[model samples]
Target: MPIYKTIAHNSQTSVKIWKITESYEDLLKPLDLKPKNLTRVLGMKSELHQRGFLSIRHLLREFGYTDQDLFYDGNGKPHLKDGKHISITHSFTFSAVVVSEDFVGIDIEKQRDKIAVIAHKFVDYELDYLNKIAENYVNDLTKIWCVKESLYKMFATNGLSFKEHCLVIPFAKKEESTVAWIDYKDKKFRYNAQFLEFEGFTCAYTLPS
Candidate 1:
C-alpha cells in the first residue's frame, strides 16, 4: 500500500508513520542493513518488519537524514549527531519515528483484545478510570493501551512500570486528541497524546515537555 503520514507539530518536532507495501529485499537495498539483525532482535520473520524498517529510513530521508546519521546510545535509544532526540517504533507492518529539538518519543501498536488481558501488567490508576466507562467500549481500551505504550517509550527504561508510573486521563470513545502525563523517578513529564486508526492498528505519539 505504501501508505505514509506525517505530522509536523512545529519546525522543532514532527512525526512520520509508514505502512510497507514493497518486497522486503527491495526495501532493504537502499539502507544496506543486515536483515538478519531485525529478524534476530525483533523476530520479524515475515516481510512486514523488513519493509517497516525501510519506511522508517525513508522517513528519516524526508528530514535530510540517512542511516549514517543514525546511531544508538548505550540504552538503545536512537540518536542523531546533531543532538536531536529521536524515538523509533514498529508494529507488524507499520513503522514510525518522532524527532524533536528536545527529548521525544513515539510508539505505534496494533489494537487487539489481547491488550485487555495484559492491561494489568501496564495499567494502574488508568484502570480505575477505564472501569468507570461502559463495558462495551473496545475502542476506549485501545486508546488506553496506546497511551501507556507511548508513555513507556518516552521513559525508555527498564525499571519503570507502566501500571504504576503511567497515568492517562479518560477521553471520549474513539477520541484521537487527548493529553496525558507520566510520573517517573519523582519527575513529572507532560505530553500531548493523540491516536489514529490505520489499517486496524492504533498509532500514538507523545511529545515530551
Candidate 2:
C-alpha cells in the first residue's frame, strides 16, 4: 500500500505512514538507495526488517526526498542533507517518517502484553495513573512507550533513560494529543505529543512546544 496515511501537522512539520503490504523486491525496485543503505538492507537477516527499511525509503519519497538526501550522525540519528530534522521508525508491518524544519521525533509500536512485564524498566511517573488490570492498560503502556521512544530519538543522546529522563503527562485514551517532558542534566525540555491508533498499533510523535 502507498502511504496508508499522511498527517500534515502544520506548514513546517508532517508525518507519513506506510503499511508494508508489498514484497521486498517490489519496495526495492523503485528506491534509488545509497550504496551503504543497499548493503545494509541486503545484510538484514529478517525479511520483516528489510521490508520495514525499504518502506521507510518509500515514505521519504512521499516527502520529496531520496535516499541520497538522508544521512545519520555518530549517534545514529537520521538527518536530511538540507538541514531538516527527520525521524524514522518501523515495526512489524508498519513504517513511518516525520520531517520538519525544527526538531521532531516519531515512533510506532505494536500493542502487546509483553510490554507490561518490563514496564518498570521504561515507565516511571506514568505508573501513578496506570492500572494494570484496566482494559486499556496495555494500550496505554504502548502509547507511553511510543512517546518516550520518540523523545529518545529526538534527543539522540547517549545515556538517556526513558524512566529516569522522560515523562508523559496524563492523558485519556480518547485524546489525540498530550504534553511530555525530558528532565535531564538538571534542565527540562518540553514537547507537544500527538498520537493515533489503528490496526492494533499505536504511533506517537513529539515536536518542540
Top TM-score prediction, candidate number: 2
Query: What TM-score do all the candidates reach, one by one?
Result: 0.85, 0.99
- Model 1 lDDT tens row, 1-209: 44388888789988888777767766766664445554452466656665676777777877779877888777677899888888888888788888889677677777676767776776677666675346634556677777777777667788877777777877776467788887888998788887788787877777764
CA deviation > 4 Å runs, candidate 1: 1-3, 32-45, 131-136
- Measured on C-alpha atoms, candidate 2 has an lDDT of 0.96
RMSD of each: 2.9, 0.6
TM-score of 2: 0.99
Clashing pairs in 1: none
Candidate 1 clashes: the total is 0
TM-score of 1: 0.85
- Span of ten consecutive residues with least summed lDDT in model 1: 32-41
